[model samples]
Structures are given as C-alpha cells and as structure tokens.
Target chain A: MRALCWHGKNDIRYEQVPDPVIEHPRDAIVRVTSCAICGSDLHLYDGFMPGMKSGDIMGHEFMGEIVDVGPGINGKVKVGDRVVVPFTIICGECEQCRRGNFSVCERTNRNKHIADKVFGHSTAGLYGYTHLTGGYPGGQAEYVRVPYADVGPVKVPNGLSDEQVLFLGDIFPTGWQAVVQCDIEPTDTVAIWGAGPVGQFCVRSAILLGAQQVICIDRLPERLAMAEAGGAIPINFEKESVVERLNDLTNGKGPQKCIDAVGLEAHATATIDSMYDRAKQAMMLETDRPHVLREMIYVCRPAGTISVPGVYGGLLDKVPFGMVMNKGLTIRTGQTHVNRWTEDLLGLIEEGQIDPSFVITHRVPLERGPEMYQTFRDKHDGCIKVVLQP
Target chain B: MQNAYGNHSGSSRAHGVARGLGWFSIALGVAEVAAPRALTRALGMDGQESLVRAYGLREIATGSAILRSENPAPWVWGRVAGDALDLATLGAGYRNQNPQQQRNLGLALAAVAGVTAADVWCARALSNGAGQQARLPMRDYRDRSGFPRPPAEMRGAARHLSIPRDMRAPEALQPYRAG
Candidate 1:
C-alpha cells in the first residue's frame, strides 16, 4: 500500500508500505476514499510539535468504505459499510468516553509514560499523530486499520460525497466545540482568529449557534475572503490594529465571545511582542508562540468567554492571567471530543444546513501529496485546503 | 497478517533508537530545507544552498525509509553512509577560526556519531525480528463492545440481500439472563 509518511520537518513522502490488518477484535479496515491535510498536520510537518517519529503516517481528516472487519466489531459495522472515522480513537466503555470526553479516554494511549510526563496525563489515541498520543497509522493511504470500530466510526448515507462528509472526522466538530464552550447568546458578538478552514467553519458555527455578529482576523486575502463568504466581518491585522478595529466594530465594547482557531504556529508582523516571541523561540526559551491567546484576551469583553480550538502542545509563557482574573474571563479548550457529537453533526449535514466541501481549494491524487504540502504550507495558489484521493 | 500491527501484535511500534534517529534526520532535514542559504552560511560553507537542499532531500528520504520500511535495515544502512558523507563535507569547517562555531560543529558531529551507533543497533534488531513474533498477542474478538447498530447499517445505501441473519443470541448460550 502507498501512504504519506512523515520523515521530518518540511519533509513528507508518499511511499509504498505494508498493508494494515486487524490486531484487535474490534478493528476494521477501511479503504480510504478521501483524506485531508489539516492545519494541525502542518504543526507536525514544520517540526514545531514534538513526539512524532519518522515513518509515522500523517493525516487525521479522512473517510472511507469498510472492506473488512474482525468479529469483535460484531454488529456495529461489517464489510462494505461506508463510514467516517473520527481522529480520536476510543473504547466507548472507558470512564472518560462514557462521560463523553472521547479525546481523553484513559485506555487508548498505550504510550502513556512519555505523555504522562509532558501533559501530566495521557490523551486518547490519535491516528497518525506523534507518540504522545498512540502512534496509530493515519488514513493518508489506500487503506487504514481503525480500532474501536463500533464506537468511533460514523456510518454515512450514500447521497453525500466523501468531501461533503469528510470533515466530520475532525475540523467541523472542533469548530463547533470551540463555540459551544462560549455559550453564545443570540445578542452576543463573536471574534475569531485565523480565517483558515477551521476558522471558516467556526464563523458559520457561531452564526448557526445564534451569535448576532462574527468577526474573523487574518492577513491572507483568500482566507479573509472565505471568512467573508461565511458571513464573518474580516479584519486584516496587517492593515489595522486588531483590537481597535474589533472594538470599533462592536461600538467600543469588545466581542462577547473570542475564539482562537490558529494554534501554535501563528505568524506575526514586525511588532515588539512578536519579535520577542520569535527571539525567545529561536533561543529555546519558549516552545509555543501565544500571540493569538494574548490578542484574544485583549479583544474580549469583560466577563466574556474565550474559547480555544487551536492545538497547543506545551507550556505557553507570559499569558495575561491578571487580565483574565480581573475581567472574570472564562477560557475553555480541549481536543475535540469527536464521538460525542458525531450523530448531531451528521444530522446537521443531512439536513443540508452546511456543505463543508466549500473550503476545499484543491483535490488531487495521493501522489501529489509531497509537492502539495509545500504549496499549502506556503499558502500559494489560493490553496485553503487540500484533499487527497487514494 | 504475520507481520501485522507493527512487526508483530502487542509490540512497541518501532524500536526506540530507530525512531529517535528518524526524528533526528527530520529535524536536520527541516533546518536544511527551510533555510539552506542561512544554514550553509552559518556552517561556514557559504554559497552552497543547492548542496544543502540535496542533502536535505537525502536526509528526508532515508529518514522516511527508516520509518516506513517493513525491513528498515537497508534504510538504516543508508543513514550510516549519509552520516559519513556529512562528516566528510564538514571536515573543512573543522579548521575555521571561530571557536564557538567550531565547538558547536564538534557537538553536532558527536551527536551524529551517537545516532549512527543506534542506527546500526536497530538495523541489527530488524534482522533478528527483535523477538516480536514469539510474543505476538493473540486477539479474542468476542471481548469487543460490539456494534452500535445492526449489521445492515454497515452496508450504507447498498442493496440488501433478503432475509439477513438475525442478531439475537441463543437462550442457553446467552451470557446474561433476565431476573
């Protein structure tokens, strides 16, 4: 089988590798119909996130048709089931999973010792991620082995194309969860950072959840245009002061809810704070660049909620704890509990409430993966998202 | 399925040392690819960006082979040869006058040497199966939590065969009995 394997920073290859088989009774083999390259995969591609091994499969956003299943899967799934597998692997029986915290399931992270030291506890097994999560092979290949098949794979209807339902595997759920944390009221105003694919989804989700106004911030014109298409007021931080622009747009009051969709690898202009972060990072003084976190706090209204869907792998330095305490801000974040909302989100897609394939800027064969990684990372060719067909 | 689920069932995905070297190759490869000019200049080999990029590709290729190959021994060997080539190229920079940079290069050389040793060790283990097959964990499919719905759901919109098998368990064989 051919799969996209991570070798190092800025280096990914589509290579021939062994076919996967059922190791557990509940395992099922899915012939991946479509897979997506996520922003989080960039965190791994850029070598910013640690714990990834060489040859680890790369990608989390994918959907496929089940071709084989172990008897352990019993009735949950069988041969020929078309399904969307969530990125987070879970045994529904675990205490955390039972509580609907599928991303932090206790039994999934077999490589618990390293994660225990880094994060103080283990996260649920994530397909194709680093060793911090269980290092399961990702779906960026012809076929992939999915564990806990009955619990995590959502069966999809035939009327929808793979692209339409593919993101149900990760980003849509993540964006929804970010806003759900804010508890937005119909009259509330929302501010979102990064108008990338996830940010576009958040813009729609915020509006769908009843926020009166949604503002998206980014410098890229295409992504800003995408946010505009999604009904968000676009703010170009490169052209104007973000906090001032957001405040002015909201009549001197900051947004009631702020969401940071950009995670660890946020690029900044030549500002003093950004310069400091760049210098500190190059010198190994800090691991994450938390410019968005600070900006989110600065533009958030007093007593409002700050929701982060962005991936932060390690400790962040010099966060404004004083402002958070003084303003009584509520900050909520987690890896998306994908299994918890699979049914609800699937229903949304079924009703034609959303068409996630809108953000797809490029679709190509898996062979183009290596070159496309460079193109997507460079943000060239109006490439907001790239979906690979294997 | 003989070598399924990472060399063998129930074993750690890959040997730790091999995975570590794979990571090392990637880190160094990323540095080379991201800013070849800057990296070559800093290494006192100014005006050699193309050379650095080529090396970056090689590093990435070998690193990928180590990670994805079912028999990673040959790929690990490629890394060993690549390491020697790197040292041979850097031999000129060892004579540079900047003691700080010189010390840094020396530390890099030592690190590479350590990684090369581990690569050799892992290559040997891959040849030996690392005792993985002997300890393969057998699967007991019935221990599963079972499906969330009937088997028909698995078929999606596909036409179903009439009179499919019933999912009910036999009365005497059922694990749980009603009170």
Candidate 2:
C-alpha cells in the first residue's frame, strides 16, 4: 500500500509499504477513499510532539469502505459498510466511554504504561499520532487497520458525499465540541482564536448554538474573510488589537465564551508573548507554546467559559494562572470524543442544516500529499483545508 | 495552486534554501569567531581582528534569528545586509596586500559574493512566497456559510439538540438577568 510516511521534521513521503491486516478481534480493514492533512499533523511534521519514529504512517482524518472485519465486530460492522474512522480509538465498555468521554477511554492505548508515566493516565489510542497513544499506522493511504473498529467508526448513509461526512472523524466534531463545552448562552459573545479549519467551524458552531456574536481572531486576510462568511466578526490580530477588539465587540465586558483553536504552534511572530514562546521553544526550555492560552485567560469575561479543542503536547511556559483564578474562568479542554458528536453532526449534514465541506479549499491526489502538507502549513493560495483523495 | 500571493508549489524549495543558508551562516560565523586572527592575517588586515570578531557575532545573531523565526524572510534580508558588509570589508582589505594575501582576499571576495547571491535569492524567495499575505487580494468566502438558511435565520438552528450535562457550564457561573 502507498501511504504518507513521516521521515523526520518537515518530511512526509508518499511511498509503498506492506498492506495492513486485521490485527484484533474488533479490528477492520478500511479501504480509504479520502483523508485530510490536519492541523495536529503539523505538530508531528514540525517535530513538536515526541515519540514519532521514522517511517510511521501519517494521518488521522479519513473515511472509507470496510473491506474486511474481524469476528468480534459480528453484525455491528461488516464488509462494504462505508464509515468515517474517528481519530481516537475507543473500547465501548470502558468507564470513560460509558460516561461519553471516549477521548480518555482507558483500555485503548496499547502503550498505556508510557502514557501513565507522562499524562498520569493513558488516554485513547489515536491513529497516525505519537506513540504516547498507540503507534497505530494511520489512514493516509489506500487502506488502514482500524482497531476497536466496531466501537469507533461511524457509518454514513450513502446519499452524502465523502466531503459532507469526512470531518466527522475529527475537525467538524472537534470544533463542535469546543463550542458545545462552552455552554454558550443566547446572550453570550463567543470569541475564538485562530481562523484555521477548526476555527472556522468554531465560528459556525457558535452561531448555530446561538451566541449573540462570534468573533474570530487570525492574521490571515483570507481566513478572516471565511470566518466572516460564517457570520463571525473577524479580527485580524496583526491589524488590530485582539484584546481591545474583543472587548469592543462585547461592549468592554470581554466575551463570555473563549476558544483557543490554534494550539501549540500559535503563529510565533505576532506578539511579545508569542515571540517569547518562540525563543523558549527554540531553546528547548518550553515544549509547547501557550500564547493563545495566555490571551484566552487574560481576556475571557469573569465567570466565562474557556473551551480548548487545540492539541498541546507538553509543558507550557508563562501561562497566566493568576488571571484565570481571579476571573473565575471555567476551562474545559481535551481531545474531541469524536464518536460522541458524530451521530448528531451527521444528522445535521443529512438534514441540510449544515454542510461540512465548505471548509475545504484544496483537493488533490494522495500522491501530492507531501506538497499539500507544505502548502497547508504555510497557508498559501488561500488554503484553509486540503482534502486528499486516495 | 500558484498565484500572485506566490507559488505555493515551490514553497518547500524556498524554505529548504533558507534553512540551509541559515546553518551555513552559523558555521561560517563560528569559524570567523574561533579564528579571527587567522582570518585577518589571511586577508592582510592583521590589526582588524576585533572588527572581524564583531562581524562574526552579527552573523551568529542574524543566523540565530533566521532559524528561530516562523517567517525568516526579514532575517534573510538581514543576511543580505551582512553579506554586503562582508564584501565592503573584503574590498577594503584588497588594497595594500602582498601578492599571496591579495590572491587569498580575491578568493574570499568570490566566496562572499556566492553566499550573497544565495542570501538575496533566499530572501526574495521567502518573501515572494508568503510575506505579502496581508497585502494580497483577499479571496472572498462570504457565500460559504455552510448553513442551509441565511446566516441570520441559522442562528440557534441547533437549539433543539441537547447539551450533555457534563459539557455544560455550572449554573452558578450562568449569567443572571433582571426580570
């Protein structure tokens, strides 16, 4: 099988590897029809996340038809079932899964001891991500081996195209979960940072869930324009002050809901804190950049909710915990329990209430996946999203 | 896709060249700093070792900035400026040198010229690729709201969906309104 493999920092190659086979009783082989280059993948591409070894297959957002299934799946999933594989692998029987916190399902991470030592407890296993989860080969190929397949893959109806449902695997549900966790009220003003794909969805999700106003902060003119299309008031942080503009939008009270969609690589050149983060990160003094986290803590309205869907790998530097404590802020953050929301988002797509495909700005063959990674990471050609066709 | 914003396809090449030049600058700077007296003697500027050491420090700083920055275009331009300073110093040393020293100075001038070309090329390549993002023609996405209805009508469109209890904010933190 031909898959995009990570060689090292900034090196992804489309090369042939041995085909994946059924590995467990609940495992299934999926013939991937489509996949995407996610924002989190850039973390590995830039060598921020630890535990990535040479030749690890790279992807976590993909959808396809089931070509084979293990006996444990039984009638739950069968051959020819079209499905979107959630990035987080979950065992349906776990306590976390029962509580609908599939992202922290304890039984899924094959390397739980390592995760236990690092994160205090292992979370869910993820495809094409770091080995701190499970070092599962990902779906950015012609095919993939999905573990705990019966529990995590969401079957999609035939009427919808791959574009409409592919994001159910990650970003769509991720953005949705970010806004939902904020518990946005009808009168609330939601301020989201980063106008990347997840940020764009955060914009629409805030509006759909009835925030009085949605403000998106980013430096890219094209991304801000897209956020505007989603009914958000765009704040180009490079042009104007994020703190001042967000305050003005909320009548100087600050937004009731704040989200950091930018994660570890938060455009390090923009602000003093971001520049500080860059210096710390370059010197290996800090493993993650917390610029957005700092801004979110500083500017969120008192008693407001801060929802984070962005991925942060390790220790962050100079986070303003004093501000968070003083403001009585509520911080909710985690990997998206993708399966928990996909069924609902799929209905939204099926009912014509929302179409997830609006986020895609570039589509190309899987062979061009390497260059697409560069283009998407650089945000060139008005590129907001790049969906790879397998 | 390629556009006036710059060729996205060649972005990797530009980045690779920029990174390579950054490392080269650092290596050359280390050599000059470690052996400033030798460099001055070779170029027939024996008493100017401190000046050579200062240029070395400048090179190290510029190279460090280039490697550290998310966007290295401005730092690459800094390299171009440093390259000019190197050429000027070498040009000044070209006079009043013995034949062997003069020959070594000419070779040094040629090496600096080659690196200067690379610095300029990398600077422009990095700039042309993404430095104009703010000034580029904004691609309009106003019609792509992803809503079936107009955005105004789509407000609270998913209100019927229930929020999970654990995901919601505490009632104590909820905003209160006057009746």
Q: Which candidate comes out best when scored by DockQ?
A: 2
lDDT of 2: 0.89
Cα lDDT of model 2 by residue, A234-337, tens digit = 99887789899888877889998999999999976566677668767878999998989999898898999899999999999888899988999999999999
Ten contiguous residues minimizing lDDT sum, candidate 1 chain A: A268-277
Clash-forming residue pairs, model 1: A8-B26, A76-B147, A81-B154
Among the numbered candidates, top lDDT falls to 2
RMSD of each: 17.9, 4.4
For residue A139, what is the lDDT in candidate 2?
88
TM-score of each: 0.70, 0.86
lDDT of 1 at B113: 81
lDDT of 1 by residue, A1-390 (tens): 999999999899999989999998999999999999999998899898888888988888889999999889878998888999999999999888888888999988889887888888888999999988988899899999999897889999999989888999999888877876776565778899998788887877776676778889988777887777666788988778998998898899899889999987777322446545655776689888899999888778887888899998776778999999998777888999987767777776776666778778788899888877876776655667889999
What would the per-residue lDDT of candidate 2 be over residues B1-179, giving only the tens digit for each residue? 44443334555577778877766776778888899999888888988989988888888778767765668899999999888998998998788889999999999999999999988888888887765454656667777888888777899999889999999898888767669
Q: Which parts of model 2 are misplaced by more than 4 Å?
A: B1-6, B9-12, B15-79, B86-117, B124-139, B177-179
**Chain B TM-scores of the candidates:** 0.61, 0.70
lDDT, model 1? 0.78
